[model samples]
Target: MCIFCKIAKKEIPAKLVLEDDDLVAFHDINAQAPIHVLVIPKQHITGIGEVTDEHVTVLGKLLVAARRIAEDAGLSQSGFRVVVNHGQHAGQTVHHLHVHVLGGRPLAWPPG
Candidate 1:
């Protein structure tokens, strides 16, 4: 199984932040900022391009969900950023598609 699947199934340990039937969000073990959460779909998809039109609603839902989680995590008025890395060159370490919500400090432009 993929690393994310393992994390979801509890086969591996992760700093879980949220979960449900179709989605899951968690704190990255190695965070880039004070608040860095990774929200992912239950099914395995390597990138946004891999998501079918049937997934469009869920895709949008993930964004809304991320916002909700961000607010819940105390970033509502403070603002935050969402990111989806598509491929290896973009810094995607897991094969599963995920939305990264980051905030709690000033973010640099032209991300490194």
Candidate 2:
């Protein structure tokens, strides 16, 4: 099973921020920003290429959850960034679909 699947199943511990029946949000182990959180669907849909219309609800839930987490972390007013790496070429180390909520600083343009 994928690492994220383990996290969703509660077999692997995660610093959870928000969780409901369909999705979960947690702190990133390798935080890129002062406030970096990962929001993922519990269904293990792999990557964006694999997502179908069936995933629309969970996908939207991910963003909604990310927004809530960012606001709770006090980044709503300061602004934040939400990103999804599509594949390995795009810097997606994990196969499972996930959203990165990054903030707590003045983010530069042309993010590399």
Candidate 3:
């Protein structure tokens, strides 16, 4: 199983922020911002490239969870960024589909 699948199955420990039947949000081990979190679906879907019609609901939930986590972390007023890296060239280290919630500081335009 992938690392994210292990996290969802409770086989690996993550700094959890939010969790539900279909999704899980946790702190990024390698944070880019003061408040950086990763929101992912429990069911592995590889990455955005693998998303299909059936993955729509879970994909939406990932955004919802990212928003909620940002708000709970007091980053809603300051603003936050939601990002998804689709492939290796996009800086996607993990194959699992996940959303990056970044905030607590100024983010530059045309982010990499």
* Model 2: CA > 4 A from native: none
Q: Worst ten-residue run, lDDT, model 3?
A: 59-68
Q: Per-residue alpha-carbon lDDT of model 3 for 10-85, expressed as tens digits?
A: 9999999899999998999999999999999999999999999999899889988988988998997889999999
> Which pairs of residues collide in candidate 3?
none
Residues 1-104 of candidate 2: C-alpha lDDT, one tens digit per residue: 99999999999999999889998889999999999999999998889899999988998898899889989999989999999999878999999999999999
lDDT of 1 at 11: 85
Quote each prediction's TM-score. 0.92, 0.97, 0.97
User: What lDDT does candidate 1 reach at residue 57?
Assistant: 77
lDDT of 2 at 53: 94
Residue 41 displacement in candidate 2 (angstroms)? 0.3
Residue 17, model 2: lDDT of 94
* Worst ten in a row by lDDT for model 2: 58-67
List the RMSD of every prediction in angstroms: 1.2, 0.7, 0.7
> What residue pairs clash in candidate 2, if any at all?
none
